[model samples]
Target chain A: MGSFVQWLIESMFLWKALIIIVIFAITLAIAAYSTWGERKVAAYIQDRRGPNRAGWGGLLQPLADAGKMFFKEDFIPAQADKWLFILGPCLSMFTALMSSAVVPFGSSFIIGGKEVFVQAIEINIGILYVFGVVSLGVYGVMIGGWASNNKFSLLGAIRAASQNISYELAMGMSIIAILMMSGTLSVREIVLQQHGGNWNIFYQPLGFLIFTICAFAECNRTPFDLPECETELVGGYHTEYSSMKLGFYLFAEYINMFASSAVTACLFFGGYNYPGMDFVERQLISGFGANAGHNVATLIGIGSMFTKILFGIFFFMWVRWTVPRFRYDQLMNLGWKGLIPLAVGNLIITAVAILSGYKLVGIWVGLALMVILISIVWSLRPKKKNAIMGA
Target chain B: MQNILNLPPIWYTFAILSVLTLFGALGTIMSKNPVHSVIYLIVTFFSISAHYILLNAQFLAAVNIIVYAGAIMVLFLFVIMFLNMKEEADEMKNNKLVTAAIVTALLLGGILIIFLRRAGKEKVDALGFNSQTGMVEILGQSLYGEYLLPFELISVLFLVAMAGAVMLAKREQGERHF
Candidate 1:
């Protein structure tokens, strides 16, 4: 076993290819299952038994959905851009799955006497890669809508594009605060930084709040989901899409949502680090020695990371259920008139604090100033004192 | 070549990342609608960030993504979406111009290839670089020490953008109050 593993690594082509294929498969599989889970979640939320007919508590629902979609008649509206119509869902799904490539699921462990990192690809700029992929995420919507040749679909896509672009300000600025404190953007480094209860939540609570809110906006989830408001947009950008193509769009969204949630957890909340994570690592390491046997330890790390991500996803779902969708104007105002300025202020405070010797004071003073300013602005709004002449 | 292969798989991931970026740029142009073009532009900026990561310039990559893809492109997309112009091909009647556009694009590609060919390539040697190098510390040191003026300038630029956005979005100055 040891010899064969060494041989595989040395071969380079074979092992890396195998690794790539495995990661690809796992990512798609996870995405597919999440679709099923989402349906079950929606059903349960709506007080209905969901898809229990398909393979024991609806375990096979995704499969059934896939089958139906594939065999369903695919149609393209005559007025649509045929090529772009085809490209839309493909682009969306591709970008969504590509993001998983850089996420570090676990630390390196010895397998068959060869040390290997658990992540599919350990790009130092993993965080950036995720960002880039996510930015491209909007393309799927844009193309699909444009190709649909429908005014409503196009309007929906336009709204989505604008909303994402707006909220991304707060999102980017907030991450900068984390980047300043953690001093690293690499997810692995971010995770390792939490060796002994150094989770970012303790240090940068405000930034975490900003990121979580923006993540919802970015995912088009909940109150921020004006782009796809069923009452207004009638299925929005995916309105003209049908068959597997439509499934692809929805599937891409859930996967992207899950992945984004994972990223949020990994960055601000300590990716896989838990309360007693170190103790578990120590005991496992002492028992197996990093080289002798360490799969269990790595698995533990992966599980912990997933737990954090699951919590983040649940948070997303909870918000989706709880919050009412915002008006379009309100959404835009939050992004531009609200979050952008706050993010900019946060960036300045973070930069100043990190540079100067007064980190704690910088944060507190910044937050206080912002609050006071907001309150002042709110109160100063010209309230119409109406003693209407109608009497 | 042997030594290069010995580098991690991520070493070649750069090639893939770069290709995705190029695709983004191409996608932008192929998209007739300016809104779609802008979305692709955002993707292009992001892919550039990915390139920064591959080069181990992690800090720059993050900042790049945040500034270009996040802030700048958002503003651009907003403006484009507001305008809502139908896909107008001023060149739609001119079949001759399509060939011109294609030829010019190809020429640009050829020039880039020539530039690449002119540069002598070297083998990978790790050279004191690693995953840890692209973190907050080095980024801060570089930004404050060397890139300080530019950093300050970004604030000015942002202020400019704010003024510009307000002016653009505002109703004509001698008009009715809201």
Candidate 2:
């Protein structure tokens, strides 16, 4: 029995299980707080005092919201496909949770003479895994909308499917530049490559912009939240959803926001890689012993990662409140015409830069050329005279 | 009991996945609703991806899920939903068509079995397998270095297909836009 206990303690799988649980809990906590944060941000932006009555500046508001959601009536439409209706939110929540598995939350720590990574799993094809999971996320919304047997819900689902498919192309193309630069698909390697402020954002600003926009579209956040646009498609895809089912759908969105922010930070903004990380690591090592210092440094990295992710969440909310949602045709035009061509151009520039062994110079020059070309096209374009203004 | 317990975990995983794959395939064909059929097909795709992962082909697994289960299946669901196919009206009522389908299915199954049997005759050293062969780095190296032409050709083919689709979908002058 003692030996079995010892073995369990020493087992890698056991440690991994513990780490997974911790990460899952942390993800849920963050997602819950993000709802509160969104409300606060929205209120502040609109010049209102948001939910301060709840524990300490609305800290416990998410809990109250969850409780209320739980107590609400769980209504399934008479015509709704019951199983698929339930499966919709489950799949959404599942995919949203699964995408975070490969994200390296921080550097590894020395634990029990073993190097324990902060990430849940470190797959070689991390980016593709995330992409696959994200792609699967559409089914949740699609299935829910369809099963609702409502015209407005069907419209919302159709809009979501097309939007996701369109933006995914540009998103994949934009990431190719980063893949070329990093030369690895693993999120850990990508983060490590961007150590000490040598971030991808500096070199691939245009690609980052495209990626960020695609990320917004992918998460179905504002400007791209056409799927749930309250103005037109009343309640949109989740029009028929009620109680905990609706809660699950809403919770999944927050989780997706958190996961995408983490991915963006890791890919471009130098995830967990603060400017003085190396210096701090060195100082800690000198002060404390090696293992302890390394562990502390890992903790600090985790802190930095969370900070960036929170800022990303804040940015999401900021844009949500600030930008007006695009018209359907305008959204399609921006995705297909604007982003795709730009991403392809960026890809070509990246390929050329890498081939010539002058990545920085080549990219900047290419960007300049693109800007000039755009300006020329803008100048040559036909302008319509406004009848009202008599231009 | 000891012998059963001593079997590698992969064997158990393979068994479960094989069962899932078969179940999903059967469900796809048998389900009444087209949307349900699509969902079942997605399940089959996911199981196939798991099989790929079991073979240590992580990249292929990811791509399989991303392409088949993700994009293609979503499109399938979208079309099925848009058509609002809730009835059994589309089901084949002709006995001739049923007989033809059965014959085709049987013939395909027979051919697949023959091929599998022939392939199984070749010796495989599971212990000596090079795990690195399935890694993305090696896959990339071979794709660009050795099979570059075929890769480019495939991409060009896709581009042509995309252009054909666009051309087919394009609105002619004086046509109703909707």
Candidate 3:
């Protein structure tokens, strides 16, 4: 029994399990704080003080909200499909948590003379894994909405399904450009490739733009949040949900926001990779021993990763407050007509650049040509007459 | 008995997944609600994807989930949800159609059993097995290098189908087709 216990303690699986739990807790904590952060950002944007009476600058607001959600009556509609209605939120939360498994939060730490990766699992098909999980996220909204037996909920669910499907095309296309350049799908390899300020965003700016827009649509954030537009669909898919079930749906959104932000940071913003990273590592190694220095550097990388993620989250909130919600037609048009075409164009240009071995210069030249073409088209277009003013 | 007791952990996983796949398939056909059936179908897809993973074909597993369970099943559920299907609608009203279905099922099962029996009798050459063939790099190389023509042709076929769909869905200026 003692030998078995020792083996258990020494096993890599035990450490990996602990790391998974830690990352899971961190994700939930960040998601909780994001709710508070959203309110503060919104309040500041609207020129009002947010919930400051709860704790120091409303630090404890999310906990208070959670408590309120827990204490509230867990209401289920009489006509609702009981099992599916419950499964909806659970599925949503599960998928949201699952997508974060592949994101390399930092570099590896050396413990017991062994390299412990900061990521939960480093699978070769990391990007595809995230996409697969995210695509399943729609079911939560769909099931919840359909099971509610409400017309409004059904509409919201339909909107979500269509929106996710439409945006996912553009998103996949955009990511293809990156994959073509990197020639790998593993998120860690992609991040490592972007070391020392050599980020993919430099080469794939247009792709990044398309990807970020699609990400917004996928997350159902403001400017693309037609699924839950209260003016039209009440609370949308979660209209019939109450108490913790409703809390789960809302918490899932925040978690999705956090996860997507982390992904964006990793994909475009050089996740966990900062300029002078090598220099800092060297300095730390000189100061401390190799293992300790490497561990410290990994911590710094983790800090940099969190900084980028927080900034991405802030950007999400900023856009939410500043941008007006898009009309449903406009949202669909942007996704299908606008972003898809642009993504395809960007992809073609990237392919040409890669083929011709011009790489950086070719991409810039392609961008210039595209800009020139767009300007010429804009100048040559027939002007519309203002029917209302007769101008 | 000794071999069974000392079997590898992967065998246990395979057994569980096989059971799940069968259970999901049964649930899909046996479920009363159309939505429930769709959910069960998704479960079956997931178990199949897991089987692909166990075979070390991670790319196939991911694509299976993304395409079948993620996209296709969502569409299935979407259509089913909007259908307003009554419980009575699930009943087989046509005896002739039911008989045809059963006959076809029996024929397919017989063929599958015959194929399985024949295949099982053949000796396996495990030495030639290359597990690395399923990795992304090797798979990509084979798809693009060896099977490029067929891949491109299939993509072209998909493009044509998409165009046909769009043309069929398009409406004339004055027509109220709906």
True contacts kept of each: 0.23, 0.97, 0.83
Docking class of 3: high
lDDT of 1 by residue, B8-105 (tens): 88867877888889999998989877866876787788788778767767768866875676556756765665576785758756889989988999
* Model 1: residues with Cα > 4 Å off, grouped in runs: A1-8, A11-23, A289-293, A348-391, B1-143, B154-158, B172-178
* lDDT at position A66, candidate 2: 95
Q: Write the per-residue lDDT of candidate 3 for residues B92-147, one digit (tens) a residue.
A: 87899899999999999999999999999986678988887778999999999999
lDDT of 1 by residue, A1-391 (tens): 9998887667544655666787677667877777666667777788988779889998998888899999999999999978879998998888788787777777775655666776767755667667766776776787687679888788888888887777766887888787778766677888788767778776666788888888888788888877678899898988999999998888887887778877877787777667787678778779877664366777787788888877777677767766789888778877777777778777777788778777767777877887898899888977667834421
- Candidate 1 clashing pairs? A183-B136
True-contact fraction in model 3 equals 0.83
Candidate closer to the true structure by DockQ (higher is better), 1 or 2: 2
Please name the candidate that would achieve the greatest DockQ relative to the true structure. 2
Predicted structure 3: lDDT = 0.92
